[model samples]
Target: MPAPPRNILASTDLHDVRWLRSSYSTGANNCVETARPRSGPETGLLAVRDSKNPAGPALLFSAGSWAGFLTAL
Candidate 1:
């Protein structure tokens, strides 16, 4: 899939981005947090990372690519 737009990507203020964890993780605490840029102009990118490692690196993906990746899992 194509990469996310450069402008949104460059301006990704990860510190302020809200993240969501999988409910499927249950009480294990082994889940990742994710955020999708607000809908409309910046809706193509998806940000994800390990909840336990908030300061660690995050993985970004184009919307389509992210859907495909999730489907494969």
Candidate 2:
């Protein structure tokens, strides 16, 4: 199989996707944000970005990888 992509796409360019913040987070933009792109190349992948930089680049991860990270945390 081919390798997964590892590119930092600008979060602002990911249009029409709803960015998610943790419920426990203050509205002060001091935490991380996540999103799921329903269309385009990002589809089926989880996108993460710093809430402090909405227009910054985002890191992508597979669902299983994200889950393992949470479990290891």
Candidate 3:
């Protein structure tokens, strides 16, 4: 089996990543934004951070895990 994805201590650690918000989000800053690291150790993981706090910690998820999570929602 593959290893599980890990969480990043800070979203700022991911330099040069473009975080995107959901189209369903209002401009209220109450939602989360997601980004994919194109290179480095974070590559292949989905990075998620709170829109309310851009420099805060980000949670990382494997692509398959993220897909499963969305499917269950």
Off by over 4 Å in 2: 1-4
**Per-residue lDDT for 1-73 in model 2, tens only?**
5665654667898877899999999979899999988887778888999999889999888899889998999
lDDT of 3 by residue, 24-57 (tens): 9998999999999887778889999999999999
By lDDT, the better pick of 1 and 2 is 2
For model 1, the stretches where C-alpha displacement exceeds 4 angstroms are 1-15, 38-43
* Steric clashes per prediction: 0, 0, 0
lDDT of 2 at 71: 98
Global CA lDDT computed for model 1: 0.66
Cα lDDT computed for each candidate against the true fold: 0.66, 0.85, 0.90
C-alpha-based local distance difference test score of model 3 = 0.90
Candidate achieving the largest lDDT:
3
**Worst lDDT 10-window in candidate 1:** 3-12
Rank order (by TM-score, best first): 3, 2, 1
